[model samples]
Target: MPTVAQIEQALFQLAPKDLAFDWDNVGHLEGSPDQEVQRVLVALDVTENVVSEAEKLGCQLIVSHHPLMNVRWHQAEMQTLRPDRYLGRLLRRLVKADISVISMHTNLDIAPGGVNDALAEALRIEDPGPMPGDETGLCRVGRLRNPVKLSDFAGEVCKALHANGVRYAGDRPVEYIAVGGGACGDEIDAVIAAGCDTFVTSDLTYHQFLDAAPKGINLIDAGHFPTEDPVCAKIVAYLEKEFPQLIIIKSTSHKEVIQYFVEGE
Candidate 1:
């Protein structure tokens, strides 16, 4: 059984925690280096639900995409209820319960065979190239073997990734696609640079879509939660192989971020 310190060292090789932005909190928000973890879980967000799920699954550590403390934190102890309205509050609860946390954000973005490339593969892309953004290179581009209409291709991204909903811009046949996982509204440049007929990612704002519309790029916004949720299982699988004795569990909160309901006539 690998100790927490040993496991953390291994993770740094996979996705270096120092690679996280100076302002971004990325590594070891809670727990101690000396602590021994018997079980762990992974999730996109470290919400209250996530902590509860970890407890339910008997996990002492949780590796999440979003950091529990993204800003400068005063203390690690949870005295009064943290009114910050951030993931810190949840982190406090987990800390009290001795649950460790590590967030893989930007480091995961640039990691080879990581989220961007994995998403591109899920989209049925061939020879999906490196990340294309000058800043925060999470966007990946490549060609689809068979061309499909904007709507059809967007639907495929949604369906294949088990996405609840997706938003798009433009209306023609889409051949090339640029993909990024989790809130890629800022990947417009990658779309234009690659001259892709379509771009698929999560979280496209109205302003973002409008900006891309003039460029004549078909942008598909697969919901953030759905697009990145599938990777948690992969994380667990990776860690399980490394630490065979430690239990690696997946999150149970498998619901769409947006609750969509259309009234039947």
Candidate 2:
């Protein structure tokens, strides 16, 4: 069985710590580095439900996309860990269960076959390449295999991502496209400048949709979890290949936490 540190090292080869943003948290966040691992649970987020699932599956470690500790918790003043709060409660559960955690955040988003690449592939973007003028390289640009009405393309995105629903804007067809996995509404300007007629991302503000139609860009606001969750499977496959002796399972209990409803439903 590999130690926690060894598994982390293997993960780093997939998405290095140096690739993470300075402000973001990545790598092993908790538990003993030397602890041996046989079963690992992979998840998009380390929620209470995910932790419980890890315990039930007899997992010795959890690999997640988002950090167990929020970036806000990295501040010096926030060092005092309280068991009463939400984050505290989750941390307590992990500590008690002896489950080690490793996270790949911004680094995963920026890696070659990471979040954005998976999103582009999910949406069927052809010949995908890096978004032009994006210094962070957090987004991808490409042409759709065939042009379709914005409404039609949005349906495809929903189906591809298993999204509960999608909100979109713009009257034009979707052809050239750009994709950023989560909370990338701010990249619309770059999308337009890169000559992409469609942008697929999540966590858009109301104003972004209002402004998109006039700019001649189709904007699809897929839910945040849907946009990023696909990468969990990618991580699972990578780990399974790298550590053939270990048992790797993607958390079946984890899914989009938010529920959507239609007016007539």
Candidate 3:
């Protein structure tokens, strides 16, 4: 079995926390480095359900996309609005149960062949290139070598990712396209300059969609978790290769924040 420190170094080399913004908390947030790895769990978010699921699966470590450690906690009130309260509780449970927490968010995004690359491959975008100003090197500029109808593209995304649904902006026939792993509305100019006629990502403001439409670029609002969750397997695959003895488990919790259907009348 690999030691926690060794596995950690492997993950860090793949996604250095320094690649992330100073404010974005990432890397190992719980447990000692020297701890022996028994089993590992990977997730898009570190939630209480995830913690419990890991506990049940006999996973002693959790690798998540979003950090439970993001933002400082000057308050101990344990309120719902508290940034870390809920996740803190989950971590506490893990700590109590001897489970460790690790995350790769922006850091993973910035890593070479990281989240965006994974997404691009999944989306089958051709002629992939790196995002501009990515001195740390996150977000790739890519094009679809073959055109896909806008709805067909969305449907393909759902099939490829096993997503519940996908949202979009623009009409049929996407000649050129841009795809960022999670919510990446700020990359509009880069997408335009990259000569993409359409963009696919999570979380699009209606106004931003409206603005992009005029520019002749289509926007797709795939759900955040759906867009990101598939990459959990990538982390597991990396770990499985790096440390053969280290057992890495996919997160069992389908903790979707958004519901697809409303209450029946």
Question: TM-score, each model?
Answer: 0.88, 0.96, 0.88
Q: Per-residue CA lDDT of candidate 2, range 84-158, in tens? A: 767777888899999999999999999999999999988889989899999888999999777898999999999
Best candidate, lDDT: 2
Candidate 3 lDDT tens digits, 114-192: 7877887888878777765544465676667788788888888878876777777786478666667787888877777
lDDT value, residue 228 of candidate 1: 73
The positional error of residue 76 in candidate 1, measured at the CA in angstroms, is 15
Error of 1 at 30 (Å): 0.5
**Cα lDDT tens digits for candidate 1, 129-148:** 86455466667778888888
How much is 258 displaced in model 3, in angstroms? 2.2
Residue pairs with colliding backbones in model 3 are 167-221
Q: Candidate 3 regions off by >4 Å?
A: 72-85, 132-136, 262-265
Using TM-score as the yardstick, the better of models 2 and 3 is 2
| Pick by lDDT: 1 or 2, better one | 2
Candidate 2 least-lDDT 10 residues: 71-80
The candidate scoring highest on TM-score is: 2
lDDT per model, in order? Answer: 0.75, 0.91, 0.77
- Overall local distance difference test of candidate 3: 0.77
